[model samples]
Target chain A: MAQIEIRDLGIDYRKPKSNEVFSAVDSVDLSVEKGEFVTIVGSSGCGKSTLLMAVAGLVDLTRGSIEIDGKRVDGPGPDRAVVFQEASLLPWRSVRGNVKFGLEMQRWSGGDLNERAMQMIRLVGLGRFSDYHPHQLSGGMRQRVNIARALAVDPEVLLMDEPFGALDAQTREIMGTELLRIWERAKKTALFVTHDIDEAIFLADKIVVMGRNPGHIKEVIKVDLPRPRNESILDSDAFHELRKRLRAHLAEDMSSMQLVQEVA
Target chain B: MIAEFFYRRQALVLGTLSMIGIVVFWQIAVDTGFINPFFISTPSQVAAEFKVQFEDGSVATNVAATLYCFVWSLGLAALVGTILGMLAGWFADVESALEPFIWFKYSAPTVAFYPLFVAGLGYGTPTIIAIAFLFALTPIYANTLSGIKNTDRDLARAARSFGARPLDIFLRVALPGSVPVMMAGLRLGVGRALTGVVVAELFGANAGLGYAITYYGQLMQTTKMMVSIVIVIALGVLLTQILSFLETRTDSWRVDSGR
Candidate 1:
């Protein structure tokens, strides 16, 4: 049985200024095995983040259902944790306090909550900054704190929505590498969303590509890359081949979107 | 050696010197008959009056009366304003219902309602406190409403994703996020409440700094009246300074770098 099962899921949002309700995601089906790392990649408005949010139970599903361990997902639960794009650390809290927030919410009484939060902070390589507030840290450091906060609760599944999207290219790459290391040690099922192709390929056991205009999954490619992948793989031939295939898939969607624009 | 010390503490030194210079100039002017002491009074005469008032305990009695009204009115205003503001911010219906009335009370001359309060509560401490409460309530309510309404959406969303219940989200995310602005509201309320107390005392109160000012003025005791005036100004500065210190303490997170 899959650890996470999302079948024929759909989501719709009403326009802010208009009464029209439009589908943000539709008929999306995916299965994530235990401890598997899956990445979802698409352009902005492709509903990739929406799909991730549905799995995290933050968004209400309009059609079908999402199940974890064969149980239906209705709302946010302690079994899952999410890392938002903006880091979203509370400005009033220090790194350790922000990390402890999830545990505090869950009413976690399993031994010492402070110790658990401190462990996660150190895991994210921010031990020295445990007492630093959000504003005292750089953008990349803030996102690391966000990741630490999510992981502190010891959730079964980790969901990320462009966790490093706001970071510079160099910092983003470093974070990706650090995330994989953490994922290996933590050994939890992770579903990451990103627009960076190399990021998606480097970190996933499978890559799900989505298209916009009533979003649907276009393809799911199984990555043949070996474990403990490094930056050097990005320069390899096989990595380039996979990148080319993914680029073609995205380019087709872009041109189709342009054609739709022209028609309108 | 002294240059660096003076440069570092320039504002304190300059402010103190400027104040002393003004008092000295005023004393010289009064002594030389350039300004009539009967009308304006000399700095030394005012100081002598302050000593007499302090020794005889009149200053203590009047200050206590004014402070009694100020504290009660400000406390009730803060409590009532915060509760109503939170309700209005959370519920659209509550906001819509309260909007017009709040604006009316905020913009209208609150002093105009003093006669009605005096008639209802009967011209004493109760009436004085009521008038001051009404004056201080609006800014606190307004700031809290805007603060809650403008809480960072991203923080709330993050808390929701962490499985925080609605109550948890409100208390932990929304309330804490709104505190800086709420403190600002409290600061404004302090100033307004002080003004309200003085104004109310001017009209109806029998024992307060404001009443003393009026009494001494009618008796043509300029030096005694100046004592009350100086106390009122000092109280305003002291209260606002304390609130500003607290505001900055709560604001440590928003400020970058310099702890």
Candidate 2:
């Protein structure tokens, strides 16, 4: 059984004055098995992030339904956690405090709560900075805290929207590896959305390539490359071949969109 | 340790020196007859009046009165204003309804309402407190409202996604996030509260610093009047320093918390 399932999902934004409905995501069907890693890659306006939001129950579906653990999603629940592009750490909280925020909201208590939060902080390599505030840490460190906060809740599914999009190339790569290491340990189903094809390939068991013009799925590609993935894998022939194939699909999707526009 | 101490106390030393310089200049002006002592009072004369007031217990009574009024009024203003402001800030319809009145209260001369307060409350500490509460409430409301509005939506959304209820998000995310601006509003309100106290007492008050200043000034007791005026100024400076100390603590939290 799928951990998360989206069938014919659609989201529309209606202008308040004109009442003209614009489709952001239309007729998208996808599913993630338990412990599977899925990445959605698309250009801007492809509604990839919107799809992730729907799965996280942050967005109301204009049509169809999303089911998680074989139950329909009505609103946000503890079964899933989302990591935003920005770290979004509360300024008044230390790193450990921030990690514990979700747990506190979930009514978790006792000494084990602190112990679990500290374990998550250490998991993200922020053991020393657990007491530090978000501003004192580097951008990468902040994102690490953001990830730890999500993971600490022990949610069955993790939804991430360009979690490392704000980082520099070096930091982004490093975070990607760190995320895999943590994900391997947690073994939770993950649905990640990003515009970076390399990031998608590096982190995903399967990649869903999205396209604009009503934001529909263009293709779903599987990464045949072996893991545990490392920097050396980027130099491998299989990685290059996969990268070329994903790029070609993206380019084709763009031209087809342009063709549709021209025909109209 | 000595160097660190000096660095920490530099502002205190400078402030004291500047105050001494002003007193010396005032004394010179009075001795040379450049300014009449009858109108302005010499530094020594003002100090003597202060000593006399202290000995007779009038200064203590007036100080207690003013502090009493300030504490009650400012405390009420902070409490009521923050609650209403947070509600208005969190809810759209409440904000829209209250916005016009808030702007009117903020822009109008608060002193004009003292006469109305006096008429309603019948000329006592209640009247004075009403004036202070009226004047001080607006800044606290405005700051909290804007602070709630300016809070990072992403943070709130993140909380919501983690299954945080509305109240939890408001208390944990919105309230703490709004503290910096709320403190700023309180600072503004504190100054306004002081003005409110003076306006109320000046109109008709039995025993307060403002009443003392007006009473002595009308009788041409320049030294006595100067003593009251100096005390009022000192109170303002002291209150501001205490608030500034609070602001610095919040500042450290902001810097480290990534706010």
TM-score per prediction, in order, is 0.94, 0.93
- Tens digits of per-residue lDDT, candidate 2, B1-259, equal 9788768999987888899999999999999999989999998988888999999999999989888899888999999999889989999899999988877796888788777877788888999999889989999999999998777898999889888898998899988889888988898888878878877888888989999989998998899999989999999888877887786678676764334
Model 2 chain B is weakest, by summed lDDT over 10 consecutive residues, at: B250-259
Clashing residue pairs, candidate 1?
A: none
Q: State the lDDT of candidate 1 residue by residue for A1-264, as single tens digits.
A: 999988999899988999799999999898999999999999878999999889888889999899998889998888899999764888999999999998988899887988999999999999999999898899899999999998888889999999999999999999989999999999999999999999999999999999998899999999989889779899989899989999998998888777666557
lDDT of each: 0.91, 0.88
Can you write out model 1's per-residue Cα lDDT over B180-238, one digit (the tens) per residue? Answer: 88999999999999999998898877899988988888999999999999999999999
Model 2 DockQ vs. reference: 0.67
Question: Which digits, one per residue and each the tens of the lDDT, describe model 2 over residues A78-119?
Answer: 898888876588877999999999888877654688899999
Model 1 compared with the native: what TM-score? 0.94
Chain B structural similarity as TM-score, candidate 2: 0.92
What level of docking quality does candidate 1 show?
A: medium
TM-score of the A chain in model 1: 0.96
| Global Cα RMSD, each model | 2.5, 3.3
